[model samples]
Target chain A: MNTFFTIVAGFLLVNIAAGLVRVYLGPTPADRMLSAQLFGTTGVAILLLLSQALSTPALVDAALVLGLLAAVAVVAFVMRVPQSEREADEE
Target chain B: MSFAGLVLDGLLALSLPVLAWRALSARDLYRAVILFITFGVILALAWARLGAPDIALAEAAIGAGITGALLLNTVGGLSRKNDKDDERPDEPTDRVGRPWRTRLAVTVPVTILAGGLAWAVLSFPAPVVDMPSLVGEAVAEGEVSHPVTAVLLDYRSYDTFLEIGVLLLAALCVWSLGLSAVRSTAPEAVSGSPVLAGFVRLLAPAMVVSGVYLLWAGTSQPGGAFQAGAVLGALGVVMVLTGLLVPSLGRGGVVRAGLALGFAVFLLVGVVSMLATGGFLAYPEGFEYGLILAIEFFLTFSIALTLTALFTTVPPREKGGGA
Candidate 1:
């Protein structure tokens, strides 16, 4: 079980890197937001896997906080985009 | 691993990466955000499979629930002309010049860090053999029932207190973003397609039932306020996205109560415990279940409201006036 989790953690780290690539190469602010959102979700997965692998309870609290903070940031950023731009897409 | 756990873990392992890939692909930003939210729920399941119920609860609440809502709300706000149309067309766009070096530099450090972390975890000596035994000693020696809850609410109560504070701060920060102008406005009253509306109605009720079950079963089982609050928060998100609930810039009495209730309940519990038992948050021996239930209930309500407010994007109404 421990080996399984270790391997799973490794896979998650790779996914996080893929997210970083998007942040690096994204063409627009929205694209960057999408990439950062990907990191937030994937980071939670990695933290949970690590907590399991190490049999440590503290990691759960850390992971929980990380998820909460990331989501909050994204929501604040998303709400900042202009209504005029939104209207153009709908029209 | 047990058969069910192995399957759950394997599914989480695959889905998370696949979702991450899609989310960053740049072609379907909305779809990617939705997929990322799904990934959070699956990760919660993975945590449950790993035998840490507390973490599982927290993951389901904060991970799948609140995060997904936040992402969806943001996606709704940015429905524009591809967000890419505004970019400078001729800006040295080094598409091919440094791709290989960029790949190497990114991949190498991630590889080493992940590898080293895993190796350390795998090779680290087991700190103790019996978790139950250690917990048992603490409970018996320290005179507390439900060591895990005690760890969260008392032994590590400082962490729990600060966590609630963080939730409050996040909500405050979201409010400070001046989001009233960007609150969703529809051509008509409706916001989603009929099919999507139908699906949400079906799913939202089930989410509520499951969230309540998780909250009630938390004592002597594998769920709690964090998970339940998160699930409820998800329901709020669904309502927002489907236009069932509108974000209004009004600090109604209900909203204030919801935001402050958790910390207040926790504080009252601590003070009462200190008065009755001469120590903070100390439940009398036979009152364990009752006390945990009360605190968890208030915590769930507070967490759910706080998460909704955090994602609501409505500003704090100015003093002596309405928005």
Candidate 2:
């Protein structure tokens, strides 16, 4: 059972690494920002799996913190992105 | 170790350096910052894998969440400055005047040093010394149930005391910089956006609950004041960004008191303990847990306020001024 969890976590981590390709080849800042959001969600999943795999329930707390605060960076990005660039993208 | 676990560890080890290289080499500052955040999350995973959930929690909260926000804010400021100077908007500023040889000269020793450190780490003897037994014995007489908290707040509390001092000093330094004038012209969140306002309303309470939960759980679990404080600090950032909480609130008497509450309480407790127990920061025998809890509560409040203040670049508004 623990091995199952570890394997799943490994696959999820690969997915996260794959998402980095978008960050690397981003045509716009928004794409890169989205990749970060993806990372947050994926990271939470990995933490959860590892918690079960390692039989240390305390790791769930780390996952909880990650989930609660993950949207913060996105909020900062949206608020700080230039008005002209935002408008250009929207149009 | 199982084959699957080994593969997972291998992938994590491999991705760390690759992700770091990609982040550092990214041409766009924004992309670089984004990649850096991802790197932080990955690093947090590594910490978890190493069985240090306490560090994992801190890394996730402060390293990824707060640091990412700070970097994004900085990137925004940099891009705006570039616009003022009519520089290219998408690309980061070009390297100025430093020759490739000079850069390589710096990189070679750093890389060798990093490799040497990694080699040392990997070669550490099997069966790492178990400190849990020692910590358990020490904490059994202390107030806190959690081993990390016991070590941090009791056994080696002077370090924690100095840490609070460092945070306060950092806040002082930021305050000394004087407020950025561009703050007045900064873009405000659109007030008409119901979606955003509703989201903030929903999320704010959840963050508060989680922060408090982390603080309370610290006595027995992996959560603690620093992690909880960071979550609350992130909450403050969200509120400020959404314009629900004005930056000037940071300067208010109540907020200022909250900012000083942790250090002041800690010092007062230490002094009182010294007078009563003949040792600084030594909790009275029967009141150990209560004192630790009291100190942690105030510490969380002050740390949250300090972080929020540091993150906000604008100066406080004058009384009676409308947003």
TM-score for all models, in order of appearance: 0.61, 0.88
lDDT of 2 by residue, B129-220 (tens): 67779899877766688999988898888899989999988887887888652241244454666777777888889999999999999999
* Candidate 2 chain B lowest-lDDT run of ten: B314-323
DockQ of each: 0.07, 0.62
Model 1: share of real contacts kept: 0.02
Candidate with best lDDT: 2
lDDT per residue, candidate 1, A1-91, as tens digits?
8778867765765666566566445445456566666666776776777677667654564455445445543433333343443223321
Counting clashing residue pairs in each candidate, in order, gives 0, 0
lDDT of 1 at B242: 42
The per-model lDDT (C-alpha) reads 0.61, 0.82
**Model 2 stretches astray by more than 4 angstroms:** A86-91, B80-130, B181-190, B314-323
DockQ for model 2 equals 0.62
